[model samples]
Target: MSAPIPNRVHYHKRDRELELGYPDGESYRLPIELLRVYSPSAEVQGHHPSEAVLQTGKRNVGLLNITQTGRYALKLHFDDGHDTGLYTWEYLHDMATHQQAWWENYLTRLERAGASRDSGVIQIHQV
Candidate 1:
């Protein structure tokens, strides 16, 4: 399939989601937390898989601002002072499609690392 182009983008603050509407009458609501954790920026995803950072304590992060990047992406300004990720249409589409799976995987990773979604919450496991 050709890249899924988004015809509309709406940020619902009350629900904490960014909705993407497609020409095909399809839409997906992505939580802000999800976007933060899976940011496409090098700071989050890193230069390589092995260098990727595990984003934790971001359950309540909000989008402070959003600006389009030419014709391909949007630069999201997160409330936590992160404003680097360029969320392209293609990247958003892929994330929307695979949200559940990726979210579950992220939860698993957090659990393994003894981290919590609540900001600054980390379990101290006795060695």
Candidate 2:
């Protein structure tokens, strides 16, 4: 079966979801943080399975920009300075379908590595 093509794409800043509407009356709301963690770039996915990097501390990440790349994909520029992942239609569909499982796996990995979703360090200034 062929992957469904997206008819409309809407990024909700407040909700932090990239909503994709398909012709088959289905819509997927992909969270910005999940998209950032599951980025398909070499920096995240790596060249080999063994070299894949586990993305941590991105619970509060947001989308900075989204640019269409040709007719097949969109380049997502994240607020955390990551702008390399080209999210293809098929890739998005796959991610949307298996989001729950993948997210659970990510949480497990984080727990094992003692990583926090809050990647940013805030400096407190006392007057």
Candidate 3:
């Protein structure tokens, strides 16, 4: 097998999906819902690991636009008005490669915490 080639990539926004393509012919279609829930913005990821917020009710989310951020990342605009995450090329690649595992882990977390991705009260106690 040949080694994977690193090439410039682009993100195309559609109604409900985002298409990512590279010059090396590697491409993937990522659902908007997944992208929204897993956004890398401070609002979603927070400043620290423990401060991360659980995103809810994003099953029907859609991408509104894609803005270039310098030469390293892209800012994704969502129909829900979420446009803070600066998705670096590395981050996007990782998300595409590990999507299934990431989603499964997310679901497991919700189940373990008795939290629903759509609606659930979260109580964070600082010690």
Tens digit per residue, CA lDDT, model 1, 1-127:
6567788988999888999999999999999999999999999989999889999999989988888899889888999999999998888988899999989999999999888899867588898
Rank order (by TM-score, best first): 1, 2, 3
Query: What TM-score do all the candidates reach, one by one?
Result: 0.93, 0.90, 0.78
Ranking by lDDT: 1, 2, 3
Scored by lDDT, model 3 comes in at 0.75
Compose the digit string of candidate 3's lDDT tens values, residues 1-127.
3323335434445457677777778877777778888899999999998988877767767776788888777888888899999988778778888889879977876666666655345646558
Give one digit per residue, the lDDT tens place, for model 2 in 1-127. 7578799988999998999999988999999999999899999999998988988889888888898999889899999999998999899999889989878988998777767777764434458
Off by over 4 Å in 1: 124-127
Clashes of each: 0, 1, 0
